[model samples]
Target chain A: MRRLNQLCCALGLFALSAMAYAGPPVEGALEKQATNWHAIIMFCIFVALSMGITYWASSRTKSTSDFYTAGGGITGMQNGLAIAGDYMSAATLLGLTALVYGQGFDGYLYMLSFFAGWPIILFMMAERLRNLGRFTFADITSFRLDQGSVRTMAAISSLTVVCFYLIAQMVGAGQLIKLLFGLDYNIAIVGVGILMMVYVTFGGMVATTWVQIIKACMLLTGGTLAMLLAFSQFGFSFHTLMEKATAVHKLGIKLMTPGSLLADPVNAISLGLGLMFGTAGLPHILMRFFTVGDAKEARKSVLYASGIVAYFFNVIFLMGLCAILVVGTNPDFFEGGTIGGKLIGGGNMVAMHLAKAVGGDMLLGFMAAVAFATILAVVSGLALAGASAISHDLYARVIKKGKATEAAEIRVSRIATIGLGIVAILLGIAFEKQNVAFMVGLAFGVAAAGNFPVLIMSMYWKGLTTRGAIVGGYGGLLSSVAFVVLSKAVWVDVLGNKAAIFPYSQPALFAMPIAFLLIYIFSKSDSSARAKAEIEAFEDQYVRAQTGFGASTASSH
Target chain B: MSSAMYERMRGNPKFQELVATRGRFAWTLSIIVLVLFYGFVMAVAFIPGTLGQPVSEGAMLTVGVAVELFLFIFFWALSALYVKRANGKFDALTAEVIKQAQKGGK
Candidate 1:
């Protein structure tokens, strides 16, 4: 039956990708162009470098700890860069800039909410997570709670977030490869899946971290260069750039205001809640804490990540503005020479088009390669996190009752990575036309609702029992997914329903509170001996969390 | 590893001071950030028209854009502040408390 199910999934995915390829060519300036050799070469170089890193990492990865945490040898600064790289995917650069090109002030608001998440993570979760966790986030939640149940719940939640996030990245990668390399959607998705699998299965966290670090540096450099070129056009004056942007944009001066994309207050607040808190709950991001040696390094990592991410966002905001003036008004970027016509490869190509306008084909190729690298790096991180949850949390701890050998665990992790990579590719092809940015938001909502509530309660609330955490965690997970399904974004937009049952698209605003309430009520009413024991153990957990007294140390490989 | 060591650390004046000071500092900064961020959200919700208004006569920039920029800088500053204190005073106090606990054990 399981083999049949796997075959069915494979056939379904093939059918989906075939359908997407058979569909009419996307309209606008991006009409079926020849593959850019320059971009392909640059991309090949990047892939070769990353594969070399993977080979090196595989040799060093001998134990479960090494596979999971890179032997906890990463420095604070390097981890910070990797975190920023993991967080600032190509969707952030391209999708966000496109939003700005199309909506102006609304895009800026999104950028702000995204950056706000980092500070909250630094303030609340980073240090404690580093102190408590060893491999996956389950290690932290299972600290004072029932190890079996808590690990199961955490594994489920982690997989949910990872799958959602993975699909979003994969979809973006497909679209990007299609645009840049002129590759078919199916082939692009498969290529990305295969490369990401190789990275995670062979290299594990060490390869993943270095990939992210390299990608982050490339992305930062590309963004900075693009911004500089844009600035040169206006003599490096913000005033002149804004003036030109206002002139070029249809909305004129009003483009600088906040009411363009999000006019509704409730929706805006809900979106804010999702972006801010959802970032804190991300499993892959939390899993990064284990790569560092100590709590201090973890804390420093968040600080550095916040700074680098903030700087990147600010640069992209300006880049997006410059794109409005440069790419939006350029006839070369429009189909049929129509003013305000559909851009090539849609709005997500705005950053790429801007690269072309400012620096021509060579820079455009460089930026495109960097963008592809960005996707590969992020997907590898997500794949690793998901695999760890499956192998470390569920298979090893829950199924084997913590008796699984190190080699067995590592083997399982690699197998899980391959499985996850395939699933992500299929889902990516399936969700190709959906807005990748909004999908990322949905992933955040799920993370915030499901994982964040259980994690926070387990850490701070002594009364939280294993049963309470499970109930709350799953409650958040189900409610978030349900609300999103009922929302206009999914029902009306994606599923073609006439109307949506849920008023808001983002579910975190409602689902998070419900999850918290369930945990509180269940914990308060519980009088079980197990609950009492867990509550009593909270003192020790608190001490360890605060002081890192008995925290896991890095092993010498 | 022992309950006695935990009890000793919890009772120590320096440990108590570290916990109280750090907790209060984190909360204060967090509340400030929440207010600033949520306040901006509220403004965008309730008084969006005001946010749409330009910062100066004939200026292209709006009040909303300017304030968002300021909030971004403020957040970075707050992070730096927290990290500074954490690495300096917090680390010092933590090391001192751990040393005293280990000394007691010896």
Candidate 2:
């Protein structure tokens, strides 16, 4: 995990000279290194603790309510930590740090985009989500519409978002495990997929929540420790750190300002839209609202979550800056033993390398284990959300017309969890060689355009009919995915095409408005009795959404 | 809830006030966030290097970093502010509205 930890030791304090030299080996780039024994031990402890919790949770998971929303008993603070854990993936640590390591201010700006989504969620979505939905967000969307069609559409979009998100996490897990534990890539993917399935299928949301809370705490502690240690090198002064970083970094003074990550106005705005609104639409994040006791707890969870995440991003920014001086100066971190050459474990290992440089081997081992646990906890959440869409929305509501027994639905969810896990493993391996950064962008894009538009309209607009929701949802879904396919990320970078059909890299700027307009137009034109009845139904839904009277109670199971 | 209770709640001035006040507050905060964030984005797009300038002459800290740090704390504070009002004043109003509606409906 420390990227040739022995070589770093043998090279000794000479690495402090900040001179460029050819790295030790030249043969395989992604080849296995010596096993990280300390990291392996720490990771084992994490796995054991999580598994024991899973076993405990399995006994209590009986009804569908218990399996999906933890019997609606989780407190605001616990759910807040859990949301932070689920939100801050390994990418938030590794990918963002690597981006800042390479691209500088651009990475920081990108991070700001991700963090901006929280207040929007708290202000606009959280309480209404808590009061209206029970098992899944689909419950809210279909509250006043035709359940079969609207729920079906919502389920499709939810799964689409979940699958793309899972792929990003799975690929990251595979690459990360391969580098850290010296394991084969395929084996790592399988191991992660199986364990995540076990968590969701057995312990469900309760187990997932605890794992996230624990992982959040570890990540916060580990990241803060690494940052503080690195900052100590320059007497805890930002100016001194920046001066040294710019002197050595290739970007020079350019690293302190905006760079190439967001150059195109359309792409930048679209990306900001995707990151901001997509968060409110994400199935796993939306599902957390149901785990809380009431709207008050839901609101508090978002508050605590926003605070923790905002603080953590600042830590990431500092870690990225510290790595420039600490890890970047040393050639032992590079593949060719050159200061500016490619990093050994690809660029994403900068944070780990920084941990080793500043806090020594022990901190690096702890961070590695925390990274593994982070991936595991996030994948479990995505799995639970995906399973609920299948079992609760599609199976029980659509197929069974909401008459399916709770036990039967729970069984379906467990089976769905196993299915999604296998799918994630296969996709992780299949796309191992592909550029996975777009997968995250595409997931957010789909969530924003495909899911968010329909959700907002349903919650706010009285004119929204089933036909309008279905049409708008599918339109947003297809167009967003279509835009990404034609965009530069997939068209040029991925497929090796000469140019992109869609110039912009993100889909939300164009896709979201189209979804809204379509919903408005179709709802306005519809004169059917069913549409009229749906409009009439909005009054009851609105009352419940505001006052929480007759809303689903906590600990209902 | 029954239609009679719903009718009563919809007619109650307190219920109306709660909805109006909460909606206004939520919308105000949402708009502020959108404007503040997108304003930064527009600045980045139109003038990318302005944020890159040092806060003071010869200073190493850039304006971009400083502004972002402020936004981070400010955004979190904004959420907390909304939560305090929503959970305290609005939530109590909601409970009263429900109680009133139930009494009148019965």
lDDT of all the models against the reference?
0.85, 0.89
Docking quality tier of candidate 2? high
Error of 1 at A93 (Å): 0.8
For residues A303-377, what per-residue lDDT tens digits would candidate 2 score against the true structure?
999899999988898899989988898988887798888888878899999998887778888999999999999
- Candidate 1 deviant stretches above 4 angstroms: A1-33, A433-438
- Report fnat in order of the candidates: 0.57, 0.87
When summed lDDT is taken over every stretch of 10 residues in candidate 2 chain B, the lowest stretch is B1-10
lDDT of 2 at A153: 95
TM-scores for every candidate against the unseen true structure: 0.94, 0.95
How good is the docking of model 2, as DockQ? 0.84
DockQ of each: 0.66, 0.84
* Residue pairs of candidate 1 with colliding backbone atoms: A30-A344
Could you tell me the lDDT of residue A163 within candidate 1? 88
